[model samples]
Target: MNVEYKRKFTAVVTALALVGIGVVLLGRDRVNAAGSGSITGTVKLTGTPPHMRGIDMSKDPYCVKQHENNPAKMENVVVSSDGGLQNVVLYISEGLSAGEVSAVPSEEPTVDQHNCMYSPHVVAMDVSQKFKVTTSDQTTHNIHPLPAPGSGNIGWNKSQPPGAPPIETNWKAPEAISVKCNIHPWMHGWQVVVKGPYAVTDEKGNFTIKNIPPGSYTVTAWQEEYGTQTAKVTVAAGQPGKADFTFKAK
Candidate 1:
C-alpha cells in the first residue's frame, strides 16, 4: 500500500473509534427521567446491629396516634433484628457529565412542621438552593443544623412559628446536614446537600435512581450509624443496572 494511503486509513480508523466512544457515552446517559443506565439492588446488614438509642417514639406527639407503645423507628434508619441492611446511599460514580446534569434545584422545597415531626425524613437538595421551613400545625418548631460535617460546623439555629412567614435558607454545606428541633428533641430528620440528584431508601430498604448515562460508576450507600458503603456498577444503553448495597450493624 502507498504511504499516504496507509496514513489516511489509520486516521479514518481513529476517528471512527472516537465517534463510537462518544456514541456509547451518550447512549448510557439518556435512558429515562434522564438516561439509559440503571441502579437497583438491596442494602443488607453486614454485622451486629447497633442497639437502638437516642430515639423516643413517645416523644413525638404526632407519632403516638400511629404507633402506640412501639419504639419509634427513626426515619430511613432500617433495623433488622435478623441482621438486615440499613441506610444505603447508592449513586453514579463515573461516566457522567455535569453539562447535562438535571438534578436542578427547585425554586421552593417545603419542609413542614406537622404533629411535631419533620415530614420528609431525608431531604435532598442542591447547594445554594432555596427550601422553605414552614409550620402547618399549631406548634412552634426550629430547624437546627448539626454543623456541616468536615466544615467545622457550628450548629446553626432557626426558629419558625405557625402562621409566620416561611424561612428561606441556603444550604452552604456540601455534605449531608442533620436537622433536629431542640424544643422537640425527638424531632429528627436529614438534609442531603447534594451537588446532583439523589434519593434515600425507604423502610423496606429499596431505592431507584433513573436517567443515568451508561458507563461505570461507584454507587455509594450511607447510613447514619453504619457509615458509607460503595460498589462498582456498569450501565448499558436504555437499561437499568442492578446496584445493591449492604450495611451490617456494628
Candidate 2:
C-alpha cells in the first residue's frame, strides 16, 4: 500500500498549493482592510452656481413622463444646497507604488440609464477594473464612449433596448472617456478611468477612498466642468487622512 499512500500525499500537496494561490488573490482584493487606512474629505463649490442647460425630452414620450414632476437639466455642474459638488472623482494620483496601482478592485461599478439620463453623471474606475452599463428606461439607448485618439482605449458604441441585459466591460488604459447616447442628444456622462483606489463625491460633496496603505499621497479631485484640483495628505494605519477642496464656478 506504499504506492497508494504516496498518491494520496501528492494530492494533498497539490491542493495546498492551490489554496495558497487563492489566498494571494483574495488578499489583493480585500487588501487586509483591517490594517489599511482611508482618505476622507469634502469638495465644495464656491461662488454662484452656473445655469445648467434644460433638456428637451419631448422627443420621447416615455422620457417626458418620467420627469413630469422634475424637469431634466444638464448635469455638467450639479451642486447641493450647501454648495457641495456632485460627481467629482477623487483618486490617489501620486506616491502609489506599482503594486498599489495594479491593485484593481474586485467590486464592479455600474452606470444606469434612467429617465433618459445617466443616473450618475460621472464614474471613476481603476485600469482593468470591470464595470457595467444598464438601461432602466423604456426607450432604446445607444451608449457611445468617446476616448481620445491614440489613448490606448478603443471606443465602442452599442445599443441597449428596454429590459436589455447589462453590458459588462473594462478599460485597458487611463483616460477621461466621455459617454453619450445617440438616441438622446441631451444625455451626457463620463468615465474617468484611472489607476489605484478612487472615490466619487456624493450629493453632499463627501468622499472616502478606502483600503489605502498608511503613507503620504497626492490626492487629485476631478470635476468634468471646472477641471481638477490636487492636495497632499498622510494616512495612518487604522486612521483616516483628510483633504478638502473647493472649486469656483467659472
Candidate 3:
C-alpha cells in the first residue's frame, strides 16, 4: 500500500476505535442511570392476626347486591396465610435531599371504590401530586377524607354519584389520611401522603420501592391498625437494599 493510503487507513481505524469507545461509555452511563438501586422487603405479623369483622351492606341494596355472593370483610389489618401483613405502607421517611427527591408524577394516582369496598385498602403518593377518587358502584357515595389537623393538608367531603367523574385533588403536606364513605359507614381506606417513593405490601406481604438514589435513609412501615415501624437502610447505586419489618399483633 502507498504511504499516504496507509496513513489514511490508520487514521480511519483510530477514529473508528474512538467512536466505539464513546458508544460503550454512553451505554454505561445509560445503564447506570437506569440501574438506580431499590429497596424491597416483606412485612410479617409476629403474633396472631385479628379476625376481620364481616361487613353488612344490607342498608344499600346496590351494595348488598355487589357483595351478595362474596361478602366483604374489614380491611383494617389484612394478614396473609403465612402471617405476612398486607396493605402496609413502606416508604423512605427521611434522608433524601430536595434535589434527590423525585418530582410529583404528572399522572394522578387513583383510589377506586368498587363492590362496596376500596379497590386498594391503602394508597400512597408524593405530596402535591394529583390524586383521583372514583367509584364504580351504582349507588351514590360520599367520600370524606380526614387528614389530621396541622398536617398542612385540608380535609374535604364530596359526593360521587353513580358514573360520576373522578374527583381530582392533591395534598399539600405529608400525612397518612384516613378516608371513609359516609353513606356506607363501614367503607374505609387510607391515603398515605409522602414526600418520596413508597410502596404498599401485596397480599403476600411483599413490597418494593424502586428508583431510590443511593443514600442512608429511615424507612418506615405503617399499618392502619398496628401503627408504624421504622428501620434504617443504606442503599448503594445499582445495589438492592433490604428493610424488613414485623408488627406485633395487639
RMSD of each: 7.6, 7.4, 3.0
Candidate 1 per-residue lDDT, tens place, 1-250, comes to 6999999999999999999998988666444425445577777776665555535546556545544555555554555554445444555545568754435646566677766667666666666677877787666678897965566435678887767788877676557678898888888877666555455665567777665667677777767666777778877666667777766555
Off by over 4 Å in 1: 1-36, 46-48, 51-76, 80-87, 101-110, 149-156, 164-168
Which digits, one per residue and each the tens of the lDDT, describe model 2 over residues 125-231? 99999999999888999999999999999999999999999999999999999999988889999999999999999999999998788889999999998999999
For each candidate in the order shown, give its overall lDDT on alpha carbons.
0.66, 0.92, 0.88
Model 2 regions lying over 4 Å from their true place: 1-35
For candidate 3, write residues 1-250 as lDDT tens digits.
Answer: 6999999999999999999999999888766754477899999998888889898888898898888788889999888889889999998889877755656767677989998898798988888888899989899989999999888989999999999999998899888899999999999899999887888899989999887777789999989888889999988777778999999999
Q: Which structure among the candidates has the greatest lDDT?
A: 2
2 or 3, which is superior by lDDT? 2
Error of 2 at 109 (Å): 0.3
Candidate 3 weakest lDDT stretch, 10 residues = 99-108
- Residue 14 lDDT (model 1): 97
Candidate 2: 10-residue stretch with minimal lDDT? 27-36
**Candidate 2, pairs of clashing residues:** none
